[model samples]
Target: MASYGGVAVSGGMPRFSDTLINGGVILEPWAGIRAYASYAEGYTVPDVGRIARAVGTAGVDIDDYVNIEPIVSNNREIGVELKRGPLDASAAYFWSTSKNGSLLVQTAIGAPFEIQRQRVEIEGLELNLSVKTPLPGLTLSTGYAHLIGRTDGSANGIDVVDRDLDGANISPDRLNIAASYVQGSLSARIQTQFFLSRQFERTPNAYPALYRFDGYDTTDISLRYQTGFGALSLSAQNIFDSFYIDYYSQTVRPNDNAHYFAGRGRNFTLSWDYRF
Candidate 1:
């Protein structure tokens, strides 16, 4: 080897030093309106317990099953909110970076991969709005999220500086919408979640099959009655029983029938809660 720890001739534990800053501020530009900005630094320890459970061989040190590396990330975000009259809305965008971000990748032998840390970057946007309708006892609410990630392409044996981060860190875009109605101690509502689709075609620069994704949506309806004793709620999920594969099962382990889990079918549930 040329050197140890980037030195001409030496051997010692790696050393690193840096300053961390975390803070945020909010300003109300006008009545019922506010703007905010923030920054934070954080790190998460690896889960040794879970890693140990996955070991099939004896005489293995679970704590040492994989590199006990912590991922340190820095995040910066800015957003604005408006709350006036019967309307409330907010939007925010964030960018994050981590020199030691962990991502999962399948092994060449078609087995689960060990946690590996690499350089990673991510960008995301969020939006939410809710309003009270004039039609008495009716309200509409919606929220949307968009996220994407990038990592050193060398992890995939490519010489490029950065490439798509894959499903381990990036989830397909999605939107959630719901409507509620209330009248005389009775409330009824419905909500739906829409999953965006993604496509990646294998080519000179990238491999697509491993990350291609399909879109799907599910809807649910619920009704509740308020009484002196408590509140009774009757709800149904995936009311239409839409048949589709889950996002992670399809994108993370594509083409693997064993892992192709289907979304839950239509089901009904009754719940009651009492006030103390």
Candidate 2:
């Protein structure tokens, strides 16, 4: 239930309607654990083609553009779970808060983008694991993720701006490991990924080396073959072809140099699935 604003049809703009209130709850005392909690409501608006090409004022009339509203959010979560036999695990934590939040200030490569309107906060963490390897059908898995954000640029109240939340809008904590196998009909999979390296602590903002994010690692392989009349698949991605430069093309670096891209060296895919 969401309805955003700003529409033009003999209208002056500014409309908002919401009927949100998410929910969650789970419990299992002990016997293998399980616990949870949750709440949510969200919205986002303002990207009308990057605010109509960064509005340079010519015929501006989207209700006079008063910070282009809508950025309402409030989310929370907590989790825990663990299965007994063959092991399986989980953990989750989440947080979000927003009040008019919007930021995309990166002007100076070809300029045109300075939209700061703030009061934002985000936090996240996730962990998962699974194991069931007595070799009968093999399975092993691992996962990890983390995120942090900050912003209090003060549009009305709170002021303690440390800014931070770049890397093209957060994303630089990663780890994943996987292995799976299924005999009969032939199936195989292998995966690996780890991208963790970030640094921040250089006030006086404004493209401080794009907020320093440099970390990379990757591996992937997959194979499948089934008989009678269908299924044949093979996949290989980044198979040790690690070149770096991600996190939103190195901090959304505006223009030129094709936005500095360089990550993609090995790739292969083959598929044929037919069953009719």
Best by TM-score: 1
| Tens-digit lDDT string for candidate 2 (148-212) | 88876534465655666766567789999999999999999898898888765334355465556
Show pairs that collide, candidate 2.
none
lDDT per residue as tens, model 1, 148-227: 77777475764333677766557889999999999999999999999998764223477676667878999999999999
Model 2 poorest 10 in a row by lDDT: 1-10
Residue 144 displacement in candidate 1 (angstroms): 1.2
- Clash number for every model? 0, 0
lDDT of 1 at 201: 28
